[model samples]
Target: MSLLEAVAMLAYYDPDSECTVMREVPFSDSAHILLRFLHSRNFQTFMDGVPQITDFRYTNEAMLGIVFDDNFAPLGMIQNSMGFLEGGTVVRKSFPQSDLLMSIPLLSDLVGSMLGKGPYFIANDAGPSPFELGKGPLYRWANFDEVGTQDDPLFQDAGGTTTYTTTENEVSDIRDVARVIFKGPLNLTEWYFSTRLVADIVAALFPFGRDYGINFLHGDKLESMPKIEFIAEQGVLSGGTFMFLPIPGERELIKGYNHMDVLTACASLPSPGSARLRRAPHWNQLATTIAIPPLLVPAPAETQTSGVADIMETIEDTLMPSLVLIISYDDGNRVSNSQTGFFCTPQGHILTALGGIRNSPMVNVKTIDRGVFKVKRVMGEERAFNLVKLTADVPASQMKPVSYNRSIPVYGTQVYAVTIPGPDEKTVTALQVTGTREIPGIGMVILTTPSIPAYYNNCPVADARGQVLGLAVSESSGGAAVDFIIPSAVILGLFVGATPVSFEDWEAREMLQGLDNTYAEAMRLLWLGRFTAAAPLFERAAKARPQDADPLYYAAACYENTKQAARAQTLYEQALKADPESVKVLFSLGLLHARAGRAKKATALFAEVVDREPRHAQGHAELVKLYAGVRNRDLMQKHLALLRGLDPDLAEDTLYEIESAGRTRR
Candidate 1:
């Protein structure tokens, strides 16, 4: 059966009705914008290694027409036709032609403003109709053709699955719209398509936004693909989809078998015969293989290295030696923590994240070959960026410091994280550059793949060539926590010819916190396990902002961390008095009371916490523990169910504890 293949799309989503309708192929707002920008000759070069804008070969109108069919004329035929709205008798009409005309000028102005072009040429000069027939396509609901059931011949090979019977009029306001178009394969496997391409288009459409949804689809081949594609409204990066249909008796399908070949290439096993179909694990693997007898030679000694693998090899061979394990010990408790660090200079200078060594009395560095050595001095620091440089007592010969790649990688560039998991071995993770940030004095920090491993913090992130891009550190952006890097330039910017000071002396420097210091910084220190350092900062903030309960609540936490139970209790009480609605403070105070053998008080406080924030998983967990301790089966089971709903993993472990405790009581 001939499956649908070789189709390109220009689509828009109506979030109100949650319907995604195909836009007029080349005349859609995004398609128009992209074509106009390309034809303007303004954008030529992008980041290094990426193809120049001209290489995609779409500068000319004829070349562009090969990929994009004018769906506008067909859509205009039914623009005046009436359609029913969801659960409404009102007949709504869509004037796609008029809507498309109005949006072009607005979009043109936006592009002209951003590109510094004085009145860019309007690609489509079709003015809006003076007489209003119906609503613009952007505001109206989408309608579908009655193409019969799923068993219809139209959908027999996934050909007519995505067919849109009607089109919405394009609107002038394109803020909620995401720009999208399908590019043909660059060669065979890779396409000219990348997030950078989509991002640039989005930037033209919306001058200021980074959290907009972008979906990427890359595959070798597909046929009768049974899946639905979602366009995210808020997601930054999402996957894409591909469909392939092999027309029966087509010469291209017989001789070249490009469509069939793509599917076979993705298969896990060798093709049994000509166009043999079989079940496989991955989506790409759902294919019939073209079977042919093979004259097999001896298996090749080595497979060709991919770009990612080559980058990883460079990291393992060259960068790993430069990385050292940093162990920091707290003053009184000698509580030690280990994080990754790397040599930054030939003089045995090491650079790592500040949070790791913030409140440590002593810090030690362990190298692969040189063994463990004490950190002699703090060389430099950028507190805001959470980066610090240190001088260790290691020999210069043992320090294979990685040099900086001065040029920051553009968004979508590939980066590698080199993490020293042990003294003798290392783990390398390849990450994609999502975006970047330029901090004043600190220079550019490269944001990469989301949710970096905690152990990867303070590790060195390098480019494909083994040049250090930056030191890996986690930062919260757009309300989602993602890891990024403080560039080597930022690390170098820290050293302003100032002489190094001993760790003890640097610890004293933190005592000079002033009015300029922020409560957020104090909270950060607290999060880093530097309770002693955070306690004073929190107290200062509490004194400065008397009405705020956060400072008092966090200060109490700092005291609790440092084992001053009474001071913690007083502060927690004061915080509660300041903000009775603060569920976290209530929960904390309850835990303190429970610790002091006040079970009834803890139970009451925990109940109040659950009441205030019903989804408070930790509060529910605490109640379960308390009820289990008292062997109160019914209450324990109730809270256990709640905990299970909130955190199944925690509930499973808690269930184990409750059963074990019951056995002990019996």
Candidate 2:
């Protein structure tokens, strides 16, 4: 016999029950071979004939066995689990030779679990066996030697006085074989798994194999038998909440299992006199509930009031003496730039921005009640924060240190910014605190609404109580007069005693590392309506960065603000030549052309802007007005429709222009 046939025979035999015979057959396919199992039908017929045997039915089985090569490696598999009809006989099917199926460890583990072994010989004992039901003499037909000895009671009769010869060669060869047997009526898809195996096996095949359940078999059919009734019990291994509902038109009997991750139910309901089982739809009559509460609303806060005049007088008396005008000069004695500063200590340490004094060789300080004095030494400097501390020979009475408010200011807090234009002359502007930001290397800086001018750079911004918050550091952005402020906490660190360096040594350090600071300073002047003062700075920045069109464009804007159109036009064209793809320059140049009556050139430039950036709302707005001027209604409406989606407010204004133009024509 072949190795697979021997293993199948050993796995199918039961010492206390009926035995099955395995027969080898020839196959002409990819399978190594085929086998047929013939179960004995006489035992089932005998049990049915006996009146004492109750609820007894034969269990149909299917098995699959794997065959290996000479090297003990898997060559192919054979299975009688799923049989098909070929010609006139039901031919058993074998799983196709595949590396994917053989490589699965679960398949090998399952096959190993069902393999059973038997002893070489049977033994008879005088005492009754534990498995005895006392029904009658249970028998196995086997030939035995008269003088031979029995070693086991596996095939002993109910009275325990039976013996048989050995036929263990067929069973002992299955030690290296792997096989599995389904003991009941076989299903093509559903394989019943014990609760212990379900955790590992069912979890691997979930969703696709979601219809798994334990099969319950009742009894055999008889001519005059009562209706067959059965109960299947399943258990779990852990504790949790569970619910059980009643079945329709039946006694309500339900229970739940612990550690049951997945529960599948399949029930059969039948009318009286029905003999066959019918499938039903899946169970879905379960319900659940949850609760939520209402949301609460918050009340508005009361605004705090403070004395503005009292704050102003306190600042003038305490901080005005320390405020000084910083002036720098070139080698020819000509003034380069000027800004504001304040004395941080009684030793004449004046703190100010580094921008105006970076490249100047002759830096001087003008105090409130003292004459102009030349700086003697550089106390400290932090270029990233745009700060420089200097000492000069000022009168002792003029060195009043300003009080600092270390507490942070919040939005909507009223504050004042003080600027010293010249000796004993000060400009104080009241501003509302807008917001604040914490920047790297600069720490926390304050932001406030704009009322101060461009020259307010380096001025001190004080709270209502006349305490200095921070020094105004940079240009205005959005609603804020200053983009950022170096807080009082950061400014106080410069007074921590350090070795003083000569003015030449301080100037020898790196000066004006980048052009961005220069451009930002120019933008501040431009935004403050100081066209003349801002134009020269923009021009200086443009000369430094020839490849950048922003400086040139803003310089042109400054000229345009002053009504110097000819100069503005020359600079605009130069900026266009520098970066032809700049959207800002393109739109500005288009506006200039439109004002100069070059309608065709202006319309073409605006069209290019819309094509480059489809969502530019202002580009469409300008196009709407230009088309309406020429009475091009169809083109005007087309661009208007595109504009409405981008900016509805701008589109409404364009629609007003279109209607106004129509009224003028009538």
Candidate 3:
């Protein structure tokens, strides 16, 4: 008989044996040597290095237990048993008995140590056994097909000479022993497959570990042959392994194989027995077998030293530090208030938004190092977005100014905006592109870009490639798209004392200057009448500077005059806190309460004003009014009489009129 046939016979008759044998072909031409060695061992050589065998068997009692525990009736158990046979015993039992056996407290802890925290049973049945019971062509050929066949004449006893009976208990006990023996080899196979599969998976998922190196096993040869393969090719990785037990010769009656082919394919690991297999270097250790290109050896000491020197040189040359410029605006009192400006210049001059520095007698330029320099000799000012131009003599001893490229026009070039946003705020980073259009109605340049929140001003224009186009300008709302740029040509003209094309645009200049003047005048008037008729102007101004306290204070006064007493009171308090010395606000607040019949409160407020400004005629007049409201005749006459003493021309008739008016109102 062939070696396969012998092995099959042995497995069929005494599958409970702890070991089995199979013939293997060696890679080298040493079959004679191996055979001679086998013969020397009396043809009973120990299979010490052979893979472990697996057993898979269960008693009828165990099976019944699994079924009954699942609340399955006897009929259900029969159906489940049939399904297990058809689907292969690897399928989980549909009954709850299998679940209970798996849940056995001690069993889980034992299995967990071996298989990690993963579930032991796939569904319900214990894993497939290596020695499976079957009656088919394979089993028949293996010489054990007639064991339970109904047609077997050896078991039939129709003659009444003897009677045989198979008790249920006996059947259950026999089945249980058979199942236990069958599972023995299977358990070993599962361990081998699981270990190799886990190692391969870890290796593939963690290529860095492989690159750094890793150690798996210390043994020379594995005792069990894992049914898995690891393949690595073209920098890709995958691996998996499983057991396969097939019916002899048929190839289709296969069972108990966990397919690792998908993992193998994904990991790009080699298949077993492939011609590509070779002695791979041991990972994670020197002098170990490793798979690598033939010529790629570890670098020599001298070469490594040279590489280090080259890296150092590169860092020294290319990592030099440089400075960046930030642009932003200052606070303003109107929508057209110029708060935006460029903070740095190509010539190292720090330009400012004209509006921000407008009223200040001196302009201060601050550096990244917190150095402040009072700027002098302001060259030119643009009233559009309130841009101011100046020049600083950057000495050769200091850092050389960045070279200006005249070929790049501000109209289409891309530029970056670097800014420090707040007075005490941290460094801010942002970028903007200069638009090509100049602003309409206003002389400032405008950008087609959307208003970026990071920019303190409107979007600065930039070229498509993100070079500096120019500082953007507009009415801070829907102004024209016309943008103004510190044109490369114009910048050059400044150094050469030549007039810029922009200067030729007299119409835009006069228009912007006129707008600036108009804005200043409007703001002045609005401030003067802030507590009276200029409420709308204050509202518009407040919208421009939400944080400015002046407009909001005046807005509150507007509310009061408009008969919004409560709103006016709140605003008065806010304004008083903001500007305690504001005589106008103090007078307004005192009169507000006096008119509202809050006599005591008004009196106290007027007294505060008098304390602050002893000669405040309005405070004195307001106090008189409060007293008249409370019908304090003596207090009213005394204050009125004092007013007449202070100004002798004060008409007796006027005092009489005031007194009569106060009396009439009360």
Candidate 3: regions farther than 4 A off:
1-549, 645-654, 662-666
Error of 3 at 51 (Å): 99
Pairs with backbone N, CA or C atoms under 3 Å apart (clashes), candidate 2: 123-152
**lDDT (Cα, tens digit) per residue for candidate 1, span 455-505:** 677688888788988778754422444456777766665655445788779
TM-score on alpha carbons, each prediction: 0.36, 0.31, 0.23
- The digit string of per-residue lDDT tens for model 2 on 361-382 reads 7899988885799988888765
Residue 596 in model 3: lDDT: 83
- Across residues 85-179, which tens digit of lDDT does each residue of candidate 3 receive? 11112222222123444367666434323222211121122233324422111111100111122232122124534212111001111122222
CA error at residue 169 for candidate 3, angstroms: 99
- Model with the higher TM-score, candidate 1 or 2: 1
